[model samples]
Target: MPELIILLLFMVAAGIVAVEIKDLLASVIALGAVGFTVAIGFIVLQAPDLAIVQIVIEILAVVFFVAVILKTTHVDSTIGRPYKGADIFTFIIFGVFALAFLYVGVRFLLINSSAGFEIAQHYIKHGLTETGAVNRVAAVILDYRALDTLGEATVLFTAVIGVLAVLRLEGRKK
Candidate 1:
């Protein structure tokens, strides 16, 4: 809805900032902003599992980006630059957005917990019989949620490939 459109716009802006920023560290921060925004979008879309995975992956990506930038870049652009009002403004904006997301996520959880529990109960009660699996966990994972599990696996594999590609590029430069 409107919230999704706003999130998409903010994500695009962050992406542009990441591309246009002169400072490497700042650019990486902007990139992280884009990733975090996407995670929020996932949460808003009622996909908490995807949001959790995206948040974890985004954290790892940001860490890797910062480490690589620090190691490879010789010049430090931020050394003599004084803190600006824009910095404080950006921090405040992010804080507000974080609070909003937290509120929405909590509200969603409160509203959906009962429904989620019922689904879980159903799975537990019938999973083994319906799936012909030995255990409830196996039946749920391998039969009931197989597509979701496969999608998550694919995402992880793609992230690993991306990291490997970056490392390979760094090696080629050496």
Candidate 2:
């Protein structure tokens, strides 16, 4: 329990440092570290599926973003990008928002979500008869939530297309 708290604090600190850091490359590295920290926390919280997804997505996103930034880096860059007080205020406001979300999330973690547990139990008991599938999650996704799964599949297909577009050559077979 104490270890998880320390890890969570570390993750939050890393994320703040990442966002506030001036160098884009350093920010990406810190963000990747923070992602690993949160992924570990997710594993500890018993959602391995979500943890795996988070880790994969975080690694892919940070790598792609960093690559794009590096590719666009030029020594002859324009200067005099003025930073106003409003910019500082904007960051402060976002930090407060993050803190609020963290507080509510921790409260939810500590509380016994009986309703959710009960719902899972109910599904486990009743869904077997409704669907021939043994796995409740698969049954729910494929049978009870056909439309939702279809939407998610569509989104995944769109993401694949976007990635292909990003990596496209000049109509060359390579």
Question: Superposing all C-alpha atoms, what RMSD in Å does each candidate have to the true structure?
Answer: 11.5, 5.0
Off by over 4 Å in 2: 74-112, 127-136, 159-174
For 1-174, candidate 2 gives per-residue lDDT tens digits of 997999999998998877677677777888899988889999898877668889999889898878888897623233346778998999999999999999998789668677558877877898889888887767778988889999999999999999899889778678
Query: Candidate 1, which segments miss by more than 4 Å at Cα?
Result: 74-141, 144-174
Error (Å) of candidate 2 at residue 51 is 1.8
- In model 2, what lDDT does residue 48 have? 72
List TM-score per model, in order: 0.50, 0.67
Local distance difference test, candidate 2: 0.83
lDDT of each: 0.85, 0.83
